[model samples]
Target: MTDQAPAPAINADRLWSRHMEMARIGPVEETGNCRLALTPEDVEARNLFARWCREAGMELTSDRAANMFARREGRDPARAAVAAGSHLDTQPHGGRFDGVSGVLTALEVIETLKDAGIETDAPLMVVNWTNEEGVRFGPGILGSAWFAGRIDDATLDDIRATDGARFAEEAAASGWRGTATPADLPMEAFFELHIEQGPMLEQAGADIGVVDAVQGLCWLDVAVTGMDAHAGTTPLPARRDALLAAAAMLVGINDMGRASGEDARVSVGRLKTATEGPSTVVGASEFVIDIRHPDQAMIAHLQEECRRVCAEVARRYGCGVEVSQRFAIPPTAFDGGCVAAVEAAAQALQLPYRRMASGALHDAANVAAHAPTSMIFVPCRDGISHNVAEYASREHLAAGANVLLRAMLAKAG
Candidate 1:
């Protein structure tokens, strides 16, 4: 048997510079990024990634949903490819490294492997799953969802961005329309490198995190309708205000999640009131509820509680209530063998590491439905994410990339 080769070290300066350059594309003053999916900024970012991949001499392919893949061919063409990558889209005030790091780090891994003259038994692919942020279209992991067959082309056509641009139009405008479907390529294993997005790794003094599972996410649009009236003329007790009902439901949501346990999280991130006038009581109000828990059954239980509380709040305000599910991604656990591969790689590098659960949903969760998959996390400062202040240190970035390199090598070899 041939002896296994040692993985090459990642260049911290190169990685840091790549991250900074990408950050400049959708630069925001508050250190938050703003590259919405299928926007001009998103186009620029995708072009830049394509340029980098081409310079590395990797074969590039785009799926029908515009998911990008840059491949490094292996000695054997018959084996399923080992893949690593993440998304390029960002939240309204997103940070530089959230999804970007994973894609860039995967590229770095390819470069490092090539430089080391290492050839694997299976081809290596760096993936850029489209709309992983779901910032523009209201659904995260759109590309991965399509890849997993959880979503279809008809549904993709119906999705519209915040600006009312249909997904099909934006996809065509961005020049990413491809014929490759998800079922066309099957992966041997998949890996993603991402920032912890939470404070777990930092608090534990670990450099890398081997993610065990991603919490299940439930998103709902709650609407309350009531009679509009003069704010001053209607007595507080007599007024049937939709906004009041929404407020009550929001408070209840917080209480329920907190009481559920440490793993539970509930957020009313977006809210809208129909009556904008100061003197008019709100006749209708709609808000989005985002709840997550590591346990699917527990999340189901929490959803029922949320529904009951919302109904009661509406009754108290003499309003009609409606709840529509926007998106629901069940709790996903990483493949045990893939987890073992990541742990073994981290141990080989002597990096301080811990096994953790992901609080935020990721493309890996969607892809896991179709293939063996896992993720590695580096610490972000203070565990802050989805904001301009999200950050990961250069040292941690290098360490995480190195771990990714080893893990990819293990799977591909």
Candidate 2:
């Protein structure tokens, strides 16, 4: 390890204060927040974030994808910027800190450096990625994907949210769009500090989490078809029961998830039946299976297993089944050197931390495709997120920010 200059400390109180203030934008009865991507609430959050960065004396820029960056230049004009931050958008029922915490922590890093008037070898950038939640219009991480060149102009423009509002129109409606292209985001390194959104850290009583990689994710939409029949007249032995088959499939899906061990994650997030009347036997069923695993091959294998299970269950129930995998992203591994910085930062602070992998998809995963990237995780209450019950302590939030500050400074220097 190289001897490095000590980074300036951040103000915990100020950080917490800013967090509460930001939470007020879309508060849900005082417990959580809700700011859907590219909506009016999203625009409100972006404007405030830009104002805060401006107050910190940072120059702001937006990309064609509408991703925001607050830049603090370095002594060497030729070096790539060292970046930190995450998205500011939230799920419809998201907690205050899910994505917002990462954005604020990065801003705190920039503010701490600016307050100290410190200059480094490379420019520093604090980014606020757009639309990470896809709650409005998604496949989430659209902003980061576009900035990384994984998405093209036509596709990005064609995206529509639940309200049928085009992504291009909504992004432009925010008025934060920039003329810069993906070519402008070639950073030397990027870091993100976010809440774990899981119980692991809290369960282990760790103060910080050094994230090494993110799990691959796949979305499966399953449907079962059967003949509709009258509940009074259909014989139990003769009738094909779609609902019963669907219940069996759900149990089978849970079993498949368990076969992958503790590292794998799977859940059925949504389900719908075709019939409305109680007397009529359900004719069809549709549901979505969400899965995450560190290994790409394992995730694929599990998908296949799910398909096989669905087929067998359908045959037993005398029904037809179809499974459609609509979306997938392979697992992402962070840069080892960048991850080391996070670990070192935690060690230097004497904060209890565990080296772990992120189960949730993050903007950092997308940034990793373009530059060296890593992440910091703090504990949230009960490992719950994207809901009104999500919670994290002020002290835990500050600890993660301080860790982010040191790691980011090392990269910037």
Candidate 3:
């Protein structure tokens, strides 16, 4: 590996200014941002990013999923590009920094390189993955999944949002979708810079987080059924309330989650009780379960336990229960080569860092399957994310950007 020039310094002020400007596209009342996938806001955001990439002399290459790849050519055309970035789509009540920070940080790296007139042996790439939040259409990481061929075009196109809009229609209307397929180019290495989105780094007083792995995640849709009856006439002993049975199951799930220790996580984020009347017993109840752990075996064991427990509770209440595993993502360990690049960068930059596993899923996790991949996480205020309150100090963000710049340089060289 050779150095064409000293790693260019990132302009902190310029980077922050760009973030604030992008925030204006999906501006919310007081603070949070909302740019659900393929919405007008999302399209506008993509345009702005593309505009910036053009200004930096990077060419746009996108896929049908609208996964934007901004490339800065290198000296050698045969070598694949070293890539970095995160998705830009935000949650309905997302903060300004969650995924957007990663995108802008990569832009900063490109701008810095442009200013320095430095080029690497292999090309550099910044990607803006689409629909990572899965708020509009799930499961999340759609673009990266397609890029990796983990999900085929037919399945991705067939997906529909809660509002009944097909992903195909939305992608077609966005006008950003391109002719290039995800497999058109090979990625030599990929790195992402993001807010830790958790309290660990802040609490540890670390300057950066070198993510080594991501926890496994499972999503289950549970349904409980029982005969509806008049609440006033149905005595407790005679009642076969679905909601009651579900309540017990939730408690049991929580207990199971705790039984495995703090690393295990389980939550019932959504629940609906159908029989709604002052004197009506709930006949049917449905809810979604989200569970995460580092151990796949433990996750599988917990899944079976959930089914067995729910079935038992339903039997006791004279109800029927069904549990379906809607989605499952096994734990992912980042590539050692990619991880070493990040570590060396942090050490060279004199930024304190911790090697840890990410509790949340990220696009890096999906891309890791195809290329050597790693992540750099800066601290966010109080670990808040996916909300308007999400924040990371500008100083910290700049530090992360420098680390990213150095890491990408290390890989691309």
Candidate 4:
């Protein structure tokens, strides 16, 4: 970190204005956006972003995954670019700042440097990763996962969107897909600026959150089977109701999570019964359990406990149960250097900040596998996010962006 170098101030008004402008592409409830990945709405957002980047004198490029990169040349052309960004796609009912702020702040950072006539040793890049919300696509953070080599080309191309469109077809249709791969545009470091998405920072009255880690997540699929019977004819003691058994399992799962520890999180977001008729007992039931923890071992332990609870509940209710692991992302500890750079930036700026772990999964988690990566979180009102009411004050956003600017400068040098 340079103590004497002049610090260029980011245009807070411009950043806020850009967010308002992007929200127009897929307007929802005036404050919400529904731009799903690879949709026409998403393409429009990308095009507008590209236009802004070009106007800022940054060259635009995209990879096979359609991860858009806006590059500003540095003093050394050969150095790997120091990157800052987050995904641009929003949840079906997402607020404006979740992923949008990261990409915009990255652009804001470089633009500020340009305004100050200051250049770094390595090129700076602003990235807009694709399919981060995954509302239209199946798995979230699709772009960064591919860039990190977690998903192969064939698998990526074969993926089908919820609207019956193939991933490859949609990427090509967007006109942003290119032959560039991660190998072509390497990164020295990646910083993702995002809303806290949780209430800790705002409740604590902190100006910034220097994120040090991201929690692990796991999904489990459970299927309970039993014979359907006439609701009126079957006696309560003789009936083997799959739905009833599933309900019991749900309660058991919640109880188990509560007993494990405060950090453990278990939730059942999706559940279905084979029989929807009110007069008939459900023959089969299925549900997905979402489990998360900051500790990988705790995640595993919690997973096993859930399985045991389901099996025991099934046996008690005379139903057959099957539990299988769907997918799991282990807890990620960010690079020490990257974490320190963000913390140092906060210290240099003399902002009130705290070192915290992200409770939500982010594209940075996948990027961390390939590059030195960390995140800076701005406090959202009431710690609310992913909702129409989601908001980060201009002052807090500016404070976080300034921290991001300093962090990127430290890494780029």
Per-residue C-alpha lDDT of model 1 across residues 143-216, encoded as one tens digit per residue: 89888988988998789888899888788888876777776677999999999998989999999999989999
> Which candidate has the highest lDDT of all?
4
Winner on lDDT between 1 and 2 is 1
lDDT for residue 104 in candidate 2, whole number 0-100: 91
Which segments of candidate 3 are over 4 A away from where they belong?
1-6, 157-173, 225-238, 311-320
Candidate 3, residue 396: Cα displacement in angstroms equals 1.9
Off by over 4 Å in 2: 1-4
- Per-residue alpha-carbon lDDT of candidate 2 for residues 1-413, written as tens digits (9 for 90 to 100): 13565677888888888888898887786677888887778889999999999998889999877899888878886899989999888887778888888999889887887788787778888899988987887788889988888889889988988999898888888997778876776799999998998899999999999999999989999999987889999997777778778889999989988877888787897988889789988889889989889889989988998999899999999989999999998999899999999999999999999999998888999999899999999999999898878888988988999999888778877
TM-score for each candidate, following the candidate numbering: 0.86, 0.93, 0.90, 0.93
Model 4 steric clash pairs = none
Q: Which pairs of residues collide in model 3?
A: none
Which whole-number lDDT from 0 to 100 does residue 402 have in model 4?
Answer: 94
lDDT of 3 by residue, 210-247 (tens): 99888898989999999899977779989889999999
Say which prediction, candidate 3 or candidate 4, comes out ahead on TM-score.
Answer: 4
lDDT of 3: 0.90
Ten residues in a row with the worst lDDT in model 4? Answer: 1-10
